[model samples]
Target: MEQLANVKAYLCAVFGAVVGGIVNLMGGWSEDLTTLLLFMGVDFILGLLIAALWKKSNKSDTGALSSYSAWRGLCRKGVSLLVILIAYRLDVTLGVEYIRSAVIFAFIANEGISILENLGIMGVKYPTALKKALDILTSKAENSESVK
Candidate 1:
């Protein structure tokens, strides 16, 4: 048991180090960024719940959560972090710290809208302002995609 405990401790230390390194690589991990990640996690969970609910209600043709959708969601979150990192680097190189905050705020807005949508799907009613804000974000995202 002592030997097993020692191995567990060693693994935990290694895991911590790896996580720390990744956090550093991903632009030093500010509170806003961490909160955004938390929001992403909650959004994903709510999405799964919504899918399960829809399946139970027999209201949709395809309401099951697939591994492909899970992987795509993870990839999307990873890309969001990558974009923030790029923005951080740009800010660093240009000797200004504005870009990172702007990027993070945009992601927060996007994730917030997603969370709200998932809640709405789960039958929660939200204010009209929420819908308007989501629409604005949607348009902004579309405009940006068109630009690219």
Candidate 2:
């Protein structure tokens, strides 16, 4: 049973990697796909969490599908695009894609964590130890990067 579970986990991870690889291949492995994938991943998780937690709350399609959520989504997209633009231009002027990629990765990680937390709020139990570890990891990473 343990072996079977391990195999299943491995297969899932492999499959996800393959799909992500193809997406990167087709999308030219640019920052665009990375950011877009991160957004979509978070969006799907958020939707799932909302569905799970508010099954009876008459989830009006307005905010999420058309109004507030939609607006917020657009704004996030704009902000992401602006950040990417700034990073790209800075890289072009300074000749350093590394800096550009770092900036984008920071934004992506921040957004990803928030999405995961939102999902957890919807009844998904994140182990306290795991959460604390991630918090420490994130803090260290941010601090290290900012200090340099």
Candidate 3:
């Protein structure tokens, strides 16, 4: 019983430290960001399923699970987080906090669209308006990128 208690305490300490480290490194964490992370995870998992397990049309090789693709997914997710970090730093430097919120909102929208697409590939019929809205948002993003 004493050994078990010691093990639990040690695990709790490690978990607390890791969580604290992430919160500090991210310049603070919020429920919105948490939801975005969850959505991103779901998107990645569904993508893997669509590629490796689902008999879906070959929209691209990304629909098939390969180690190369897995690594690519990891890199993409990492870059997403890095973008958020950069946004937070920008907010700090500019003395304005809106950049982080904007970045998080953009990422959440993108993740939501990816999740919906993944569900569609899995044979779920989503509302037509949802796709249209996503298309509009995507095009707007593209336009903004082109302007930059």
Name the best candidate (by lDDT).
Answer: 3
Better of 2 and 3 by lDDT: 3
lDDT of 2 by residue, 3-122 (tens): 999999999999999877654434235754466566656665575446454542124453233345545655776666566566666667887555455555566556657666665656
Candidate 1 per-residue lDDT over residues 47-120, each given as its tens digit? 77776655422223476766677677889988988898788788888897667766776787788888886776
- Can you write out model 3's per-residue Cα lDDT over 37-95, one digit (the tens) per residue? 99889988888788889845244454556777767777998899888888888889989
What's the residue-level lDDT of 97 in candidate 2? Answer: 50
The TM-scores, one per candidate, come to 0.77, 0.53, 0.73
Select the stronger candidate by TM-score from 2 and 3: 3
Candidates' C-alpha lDDT:
0.76, 0.59, 0.77
For all the candidates, what are their Cα RMSDs to the real structure?
A: 4.6, 10.0, 3.9
Q: Best to worst by TM-score, what's the order?
A: 1, 3, 2
**Which regions of candidate 3 fall more than 4 Å away from where they truly are?**
1-12, 55-63, 128-148
